[model samples]
Every structure is written in C-alpha cells, then in structure tokens.
Target: MARPLSPKLSPSIIAQAALDAVDHDGEFTIQGIAKKLKVSPSSLYNHIDSKADVIELMRGQVMGRMDLSGVDSESADWAGSLRIIALHYRNAYALNPRLLPLVTAYSVRDATTIGMYNLMAQTLRTAGFDSTRQLEIITVIDNFVLGSALDAGAPDNVWAPGEAASPELRAALDAGLGAPDRAQKSFEFGLGLLLEGLAREAEVLG
Candidate 1:
C-alpha cells in the first residue's frame, strides 16, 4: 500500500494538540496528546523526542504570533523598539496564561522565542547598553512582561481586602479593580515607568 501524500503527523500538529490540552486542562501528557490526535502514544515519539521538545514547540507557537520584524533596531529609538517588543511579548503570553509557567520552567530553546530576544538585545546594543547591562535589561523586561501577562488572567477582583483593608488600599482598589482593561492599563503604566528608568540609565552610560 502506498503511504499517504501527507505524513500522519507533524510537529505543528503535535504541538497544537498539546497546547489545546494545556489550554483546557492546564497541563499535557504525551499520551494525552496522542489520544487527542487519534494516534498511539508511541507514534508521538517519531516526531518529538520528549516532553521538553513539545514544550519548545508550544513556546514557538506562542512566540510565532508576534511580528518581531517590526522592531527597528537601526532607528536608534531603543525605548520605542523595546516597548513594541514588550507589548507584543505580553500580548502573546496573555493568550495562553496557562502555558507561561510551563514555558518558564523549561530552558527556552525555541528558535522563534530566541529570535525575539535577539531583537531586543540588538535594540539595546544599538542604544549603547554594554553586554552585561544588555542581559540585565532583558531579564528585567522578561520578568515584567511575564508578570503582566499573568495579571491579564487575574480575577476581576484581584484583591479583596474587605474589613481588613486600610482606607488607602480600599480606595485604590475601588478606583482601579474591575476597571475595564485594568490589566492592560496597569501593564502600560508599569512599562512606561520601566522605560523611563532605562532611558535615564542609557543617558548616564553615555
């Protein structure tokens, strides 16, 4: 019998199956993905070596959603470039908040994800950040973006101080919590603060 024109499974298919599982169940297993794909668990090994490989593929799927090429390292507007990249990164993860923990647990070996980092590094290098500072800046941005992404999935009432709440804390939550696009507004506000500080640091480094 002749084999089918298209192979039975591809990396993208496997990754998407696992991602679907994660999206619904908050985790995935090789067997689970195989069942989802209507294939035996052993067949999954033909396309993926281990769970880490599937995680990387899922990472790539998320990262592929962002268009990083729009970042203009040559423009010398490092803050602008960084902001664009950060927003893109945060938005991508916001779609799959459950995947965030898994991706963070594993070492990032996904080419697309690494490419996004490379663009950010290039933007920093172009703006006069030294190699040491580049990594630090990238890490800071990564932490902030991930935290903000998690916030996107936060409950409408992120904090419920109730009777225990101080007047100031209660007032703050009353004004901000449950606000429309609260998470996005907060992320932008925080991003602005970070960019301002980094801009000052860049000036001092010059």
Candidate 2:
C-alpha cells in the first residue's frame, strides 16, 4: 500500500492540537491532547519530549505572529522602534490571552520569541542603555506587554465597584469602563507613560 502524502503526525500538528486544548481548557495534558488528536499518548511522546515542549511550541505559535523585521533597532528613532515592537508583541499575545499564564510559568525556549527579545535588547542598546539597564528595560516591557495582553481580553465591565465605589472612582469608571477602544486606548496611554519614563532615563543614564 502507498504511504499517505502527508504524514499523520508532525510537530506542527501536535503543537496545534495542544494549543487547541489550551484554548478550550486553559490547560492541557498528554492524554487530553492525544485524545483531541485521536492519537495514542505514546505517539505524542514521540513528537514532543514532554508537556514543556508543547508549551514552548504554543508560545512560538503565538509569538511567531510578531513581525520585527521591519523594526530597525539601529535607527535613530529607537524609542519609536521599541514602541512598534511592543505593539506587535502585545497584539500577538492578545490573540491567545489564555496561554499567558502557562507560558509565564515555563522558561521561554522558543527561538522566534527569543529573537523578538534579542531585537528589543538591540533597540535598547541603540537607545544608549547599558547591559544591566537593557535587561531591566526588557523585563519592564515584558511585564507591561503581558499585562496589557491580558487586559485586551478583559470583560467589558472591568470594574464593578457598585455602591462601594467612591464618587471619584465611580465617575472614572462610568466615563471610561466599557468605552469603545477602552483597552487599546488604555494600553497606548500606558505605553506612552513607559516610553516617556524610559526617555528620561536615557537622558541621564545613557
């Protein structure tokens, strides 16, 4: 009998199955993925070493959506470049917010994702940041972007303080909460504040 044109199992296929499981269940197990793929658990083991490998694959799937090639770390507009990269990174993760917790729990080993970090580091270097500051800036950006990504998936009523809300807090939430583009606007506002702070640091610390 002739073999199938496409193999039944492959890394991408397994990874996708695992990703789907995570999307639906917020977590995945070897047996869950195997059943989802209608394959034996041993078959999955053949493709991936362990659940950690699957997590990394899922991280790649999400982070791979980021396009950093057009971003020029060597440009004089290093801050602008970093801003663009942050938007790309946040948008990519916004698609799979549920995957955030799992990925954060595991050490990142995805090459594509690491490549994005490498570009961010280069951008900071161009902005006159030293090695220590570079790592610090990167961590700040990582934490902020991840939090923003989760925010993008937040419910329309992000805060429901009800009667307990102080007049000031109530007024703020009433005006902004569930507003159109609330998440995007909030993220841009926050990113601007971060960039401004970084700019100030660059002047003194560069």
Maximum-lDDT candidate: 1
* Count of clashes, each model: 0, 0
| Candidate 1 per-residue C-alpha lDDT over 78-193 given as tens digits, one digit per residue, 9 for 90 to 100 | 89999999999999999889998899999999999999888888899988999999999999999999999999988998998779999999989988889979999999999999
The alpha-carbon RMSD values of the candidates against the true structure, listed in the order shown, are 2.0, 1.9
* Candidate 1: clashing pairs of residues: none
Q: Write candidate 2's Cα lDDT for 1-206 as tens digits.
A: 98545348877787788788877889989998788777779878887898899999888888878878799889978889989999999999898888989999999898989899889998899989999989989999999999999999889999988789999999999889888799999899999999999999888965
Name the runs in model 2 displaced over 4 angstroms: 1-7
In order of appearance, the predictions have TM-scores of 0.94, 0.93
Error of 1 at 12 (Å): 1.7
How does candidate 2 score on lDDT? 0.88
lDDT of each: 0.91, 0.88
